[model samples]
Target: MVELLTARGCDVIATVGDGDGLLAAVATHAPDVAVVDIRMPPTHTDEGIRAAIQLRAAHPGVGVLVFSQHAEPAWAARLLAGEASGIGYLLKERVSATADFIEALHRVAAGGVALDPEIVSRMFNTGSRPLDRLTERERVVLDLMAQGHSNRSIAELLVISERAVEKHAASIFTKFDLPPTAADNRRVKAVVAYLQESKP
Candidate 1:
C-alpha cells in the first residue's frame, strides 16, 4: 500500500508492522490519514481497529481507513462508534480497485466516510445492531457506568453535570427496553445488556 500510494504521488509517511509501531508512527508523522489493516502482529484479531479508535480519540484530526480480509460487521460497528466523520472501512478485495481505494483514502482525509458496499449491506441487516440505538454520548456514559462508576463519578469524569448523566442513563435504559421496575435493577440490566451486545 505504501508503494502504491507513493507511486500515485501520495506521500507515504511511514509504515509499521504492529499496532504499537503504528501508534508511534502516527504520533511522530501526524499524517492526514492512516491506512490500517484489521489484522496485526501478536494477536491478529482486532488490534488495528482498537488502535484506530485510540488514535481518533487522541488525534481527532487524523482520519482512519481499515481493511479486512472478510466481512466483519462487529468491527465496523466499533470502528464507526456512532460517528462517521473521517472514517473508512474497506474489504481487502477493494484494494484491487486502485482508483476506488485511492478515492476512499482521499475522501476519509477530507472528513468524509467511505464504506465498502458489502460492509454497508451487512451493517444494515436486521438484528445486527444490538446496541446501535444508543447515541454516542449515551454509549460513553454506559461504558463508564459498566466500570462501576456512580452517577456523580461519571459526571466528574466526563466533566458534565450529574443531572445530565442521569438523563443519559435514563435514555440508555429506555433504549435497552428496561422499563421501570422495583424488583429488577434496571441499571444492572442495562449494564449487562451493554456487556453482552458490545462485544466483538
Candidate 2:
C-alpha cells in the first residue's frame, strides 16, 4: 500500500508494523501526515487509536488518518477532541477504492477534518455533551490547546495578546466547570475531557 501510494504521486514517508513503530516514525520523519491501521500488532485493542492521540498531542502539525475495519465511535471521539485539524478516521474498506482513499488522505494533509460516514452515523447513537456554551473563538482556542499549543502560540495564531489568551482560557474553564489548578495540569485535564466528548 505504501508503494502504491508513492507510485501515485503521494509521498509515503514511512511504514511501520505497530503503534510503537508509528510513534517512532512520527518522531523521526515528522511527516506531514500519517496513514495508520487502527488494528496494529501487539495486542491490537485500540493501540493504533491511542498512538494517534499521543501523536496529536505531541505534534499537532502532523495529520493522522486512522483506518479500521469497524466503526468505533469512541476512538473517533478521542481523535476529534480538542483540535480537529488534519485528522481523519475511516474504515479499511474505503481503501479499496483508490480515488476515494487518496482524496481522504489529501483532505487531512491539507488541514481539513474527515470522518467516515459510517463512523459519523454511529457517533449519533452515543450520548454527547452540549458544547454550545462556548463561543466560536473559545472553541478554536480550546482546540489549539488540545493540540498542545502554548498560550503564546495560540495568541500569535489568533492575533491576540498573551494576556487576552489567558483570560479566554480561564473563561473556558469556568464554563466547563473545571476547577482552579496548575496551568499545565489543567491543560491536560481539559484535553482529556475534550477528547472524551468530541465524538459527533
Candidate 3:
C-alpha cells in the first residue's frame, strides 16, 4: 500500500504496527492524512476503527482513510458517528485500482467524503423508511451526495442540469425531514440517516 501511494507521488510517512503507534506517529509527524487498516495486531477486530475515531477527535485537521478487508456498515457507521468530512472508507479490494485509490486519498485529504459505492448501495438497500420515500432519481442524487460530490459534479455525472441536482437535494432533505441546521452538516446528516438505518 505504501508503495502504491508513494508511486502515486504521496509522501510516505512513518508506518507503525499497532494503533497506539499510529496515534503517536500522527501526533509527532502530523501527516496530512493517515491510511489505516481496520483490523490491527492484537485483536485484529476493530482496533483500527477505534484508533481512527480517536485520531479524528484528537486532530480533526488530519484526514483519515479506513481501508478494510471486509465491508462492515456497522463499523462504518460507528466511525462516522459525529463528523464525515475529511474521512473515507473503502474496501481493500479497491486498492487494486491505482487511479481510483489515489483519487479517494486526494478527496479525503481535501476534507471530502469518499465512501465506497458498495457501502452506499448497502446503506440504500437497508430499508430505511425515509429513503423509501425518495424517487429513483432522488436516490441517485443522494448516493452521489453521500460520496461527497458537489451539486455540479453530480450534475455532470448524471448529465443533468445543476438546477435539477439542487431540486433532488431539496427533495431528499425534505423527505428525510432534515431541515437546514447550523449545528449539523446536511450532507453528513443525510449520510448518517442512511447509515443509522442500516444498523442491524
Candidate 4:
C-alpha cells in the first residue's frame, strides 16, 4: 500500500504495527490520510475500528480510509458514526484494483465518501421493506450509487442512457425519503438511512 501511494506521488510518512503504534505514528507523521486494517495484533477483533474512531476524535483533519476483508455492516456503521466527510470504508477486494483503490484514497483525502458496493448490499439485506420499495432496476441504480459511481459511469456500466440513470436515482431518493436539498447530500443520506436501518 505504501509503495502504491508513493508511486501515486503521496508521501509515505510512517508505518506502524498495532493500533497504539498507528495512533503514535499519526500523531508524529500527521499524514494527510491513514489507511487502516480492520484487524490488528492481540485481540485483533475490532482494534483497528477502535483506533480509527480514536484517530478521528484526536485528529479531525486527518482522513481515514479503512480497508478490510470483513464487510460487516455493524463495523462499517460504527466507523461512520459521527462525520461522513473525509472517511471511507472499503472491502479488501476493492483494494486489489489499483486504480479504484487509489481513487478511494484520493476521494477520502479530498473529503468524500468511498463506501464499498458489497457493504451497501449487506446493509440492504439487513434492511426491512425500505429496499423492497424499489424495483429491481432502481435497486441496481441505488447499488451503483452506493458504490460511489457517477451517473454517467452507472449508465455505462448498466448500458443505459444517462437520463435513465438520473431518473432512477431520483426515484431512489424519493423512495428512500431523501429529499433533494442543499443542506444534506441526498446520496449519502440515503446510504446512511440504509446503514441506520441495518442490523448487525
Query: Model 2 over residues 1-200: C-alpha lDDT tens digits?
Result: 88769877988877898878889989999998998877777887778888899999998999899988998767877777757678888889888878878887887887766667676444334434524667768777876665446799999999999999999888878776789854435654554464467544
Clashing residue pairs for model 1? none
What is the TM-score (0 to 1) of candidate 3?
0.95
Q: How close is candidate 2 to the true structure, as a TM-score?
A: 0.63
Q: Write the per-residue lDDT of candidate 3 for residues 73-114, one digit (tens) a residue.
A: 888898888677888999999999889889999999988888
lDDT of 3 at 126: 71
Task: Give the range of the ten consecutive residues with the poorest summed lDDT in model 1.
Answer: 120-129
Q: Compare the candidates by lDDT and give the number of the best one.
A: 3
Per-residue lDDT tens digits of candidate 4, residues 117-146? 788878667646778899989888878877
lDDT of 3 at 199: 68
Error of 4 at 139 (Å): 1.0
Q: Would you list the rank order by lDDT, best first?
A: 3, 4, 1, 2
Q: Could you say which candidate leads in TM-score?
A: 3
Question: How high is the lDDT of residue 193 in model 2?
Answer: 60
Q: Which stretches of model 4 miss by more than 4 angstroms?
A: none
Please provide TM-scores, in order, for all candidate models, with all chains considered together: 0.63, 0.63, 0.95, 0.86
Once fitted onto the true fold, the runs of candidate 1 whose alpha carbons sit more than 4 angstroms away are 127-200
